[model samples]
Target: MSESSESTIESGGIGLSEDALRTLKLVADDEPIPDDDPGLRDLRALHAVVPNTHRPGHWILLDPQQTAHNLLWRGIEEVTGILDRLTHVPKITEALTVEHERGRWRDGVGSEYIEHADQINARLDQIMASATEELLTAQPRKRSKSLLTMALPRDSALLERGCKMRTLYPYSARVGVHEPKWMREMAKRGAAVRTLSIPFPRMIIVDRRHAFIEDLVFDSSPPHSGWYVTDRPVVEWMSMIFDLYWTRADPWSEPLDQAGRLTNPIQRSILRELVAGLDQKQIANRLQISEKTLSNHLTDLRTKLRFKTTYQVVHWWATAAENSSALELRDGEPFPNFPGTEGP
Candidate 1:
């Protein structure tokens, strides 16, 4: 056979190998081939040859072209059936999804516990890739440089697709070296970045439909285990929380603008915690700042105000003009009035 013909035969044209074709050809010429040959079994399987009943151990070869035609016709039918099934896959998947979601509203809510960092990242990527409306994230603590690096492209793509992105970070994050750069880059890409002095729960909300939050069971650890929430009520509540903080937050444009005020929001938060009877370490932990950084703020306050002790600072903060109003951290929740201040 020519090279092209052999190529066709090898490509399942007739579902017969070259060896089988050769065996068939030999049988057609009445050549005495071995009865136990492997090609003989293949030729028989393809119906390309039949046993000669009158001549024991002899075979009869059918027309190769006819055998090829029959085999190709059957293959074509199988392929057509597969194509028909392939066309139904998307519709079938959609129907199954609808069925799975049936009565889910009455079932209260749906949540998944993602137990690992990689899985959480993958799920977020999947969710963000299809997000159309907005993404709201509250990161109370500073993010690692590596995590920020990995998220830049994914976030930029979300912004490029016209998704409104807003992120909330603690005031301490603004002083970080790498995080500020990441925040600035994101802000430049039309993302609304803000910082709050008050501590808030970390969460990510996509399109106001889904939310991801820390498990709180592992909040003291470094792993990224978390909960994926799809309940409309729960997600809406988280979104509301984010909006409340965002309302009181300062924008990324002015990182350290005092506005002629003596203390920044972060310093005010430290003072607030101090007046609430928290020690230096506890205040630092709550504000997501290091103890050293917290001490620096105190030292700066003491030096600027010409005071010698933290007690003096707290004394002044209680009677300060700014602490008079109720500090609203959440809906209907406000800080209690200090000793020298009046309630709202």
Candidate 2:
């Protein structure tokens, strides 16, 4: 509706301005502005000063606090309506939806990239605080003591609330000094931690409702850059990746088989060589190791895998890796599955 064509009512000698009347129409009657009107500045000013507005015909009545609250709620609803359109939950494709949806966000996808450390941390704090059920994270980089200090309290608080927490890291994360300390502290707080040799994305998902995908740019001083995502499909997709890693990942605990898990740098290199079909002498020469030592490490690798042959060791490692899960993204629901591979 455009402005009510009703004649303006004068209160005593005073009359409502065109801007005030237009503004009243918007709040009370959902009127549309057909074009740029000079009166809009006054309308905006009226909205700024008044919390509640009403109109009987053409004149507007305003209550200071109520008018502001009314306008504030309208702004929030405006945002919600916008989100209702953009937030998408992709239709389930060939894959199964993640079982946990306690904190799923219905809002369509929208994103912001954070560049400052303070902004990123604040966003993280907000997400973690909002999480009512679970927190999933994949952090592929090294942790410094300072970062761990900042994270400790917030993470432990979530655990206290009985929220399931799971984190993913590369196998190398297990070797780092600070990583071990942080992992142990979190484990004590009832969080599950796992390591996969395969490369993992750097991201964090809170209650399946939000995801923060880390930026690949590491050049900034404080190193802050990532997307804060609330799109259902995107968050769910991230959840599946975390779950896939969870299934194939080695537990930070000792309940699982210790076999094939201890891979030192040299041994890891040798295994890579073997998988490349390098002979013992060729592998030894490349690593500048004596053939005898190379053979020892290779033998240890096979023994740890409980297989007599180097090929068997490679096959075993490959099989364990397949459980890491793969995703095929399409317009439809993407199911998490193990894509076919020739070998590890």
Candidate 3:
């Protein structure tokens, strides 16, 4: 048979055609095997059975009894074939495809390529356009004019869409009249406001689907200018971080205690630090306790007075002290008696 035909037959599996068998017989006949030739009897036996089975390989010829043994080998080959196709080839192809796609997308559309402020703004606008249900924000004590300018308009638009809004601020914001006024207005129009002494991470989650976190380098900058936007995995990570602080934060329903009425040593310690404007970490260090433990005590105090922000706590303490002083002045003897002794 031709070499091309032989290659085609080998590609399928080793099988003897009539022409190939005729050629094999002629070759075996011409190669005369003497009676003393090693394994001459075995060769003659193999040639006898070569035309009987479909596979004309030596295994069937030399050991026809081991034909059943080929079943075990065939089973192994079948299993190897399946594993190569399913587990090896397809998995490698999928991984390579994913990596190639990721490289192309990142190289072409990644945030690192955005150089201008307008490019960043445009990206955020695209995100905002798709937001559906809710938006949660945490802003720092100090606000920038540009952020406020952009945020106020965006906040208004979100409110009009009936999105639920929640904002967290530092207690120091109470010193700014404008912040409280803004909070009150936002609260009046379906937003909730809360305050904590702890500093909050700058974050925004839209509809629980997309979240934007301030990049480490841009933590102190405007978020729209430098932030990462992603889905669940990143958002859930930021949400956990927020909950770590939120659990320690005082509830908004608590009324402010202005008076220094917190007399317990731990409560008083926390109160003194608050009055001194020391942060929670400093208070924890001074008292030789963990910040988490200090926060627990503060939370206990908040529950007692029904106050939220540390500012409200201090404000309540001051109000109580003023009331006590006014009562003391009322109890003092009238000064008029000294000037009008002749009235008797």
Clashes of each: 0, 12, 12
lDDT (C-alpha, whole model) for all candidates: 0.81, 0.65, 0.56
Give Cα distance to truth, residue 114, candidate 2, Å: 1.0
Q: Clashes in model 1: which pairs?
A: none
lDDT of 2 by residue, 1-344 (tens): 22422122222112346665556567455444333443443544435432333522233345758766866776688789888866554534212242122113212236655657778889899879867999998876677889889999999999998899999776656656688888999999999998754445788899998888875533332456566888787788778777765665666764433345455544655666777788888876555456887778778877766887877877775656422323111124344563463356
Candidate number that wins on TM-score, 2 or 3: 2
**Per-residue error (Å), model 2, residue 309:** 14
For candidate 3, give the lDDT of residue 257. 46
Top candidate when judged by TM-score against the true structure: 1
TM-score, every prediction = 0.62, 0.48, 0.41
* Model 3 C-alpha lDDT per residue in residues 1-344, reported as the tens digit of each score: 34544443445443454444554454355443334332333333224323323333322233545644664576579789987788677768877775565445445422232334566666666777677787777765555456556666677678888787877765545545456666666777777776665445777667666665544542233444444456466676666565554544443444444344553334554666777788988876555456777778777767878988767776776655432322211123332222235564
lDDT of 1 by residue, 23-47 (tens): 8777878777677776786677677
The CA lDDT at 30 in model 2 is 44
Total residue pair clashes for candidate 1:
0
Measured by lDDT, the strongest candidate is 1
* Candidate rank order under TM-score: 1, 2, 3
Cα deviation at 88, candidate 2, in Å, is 41
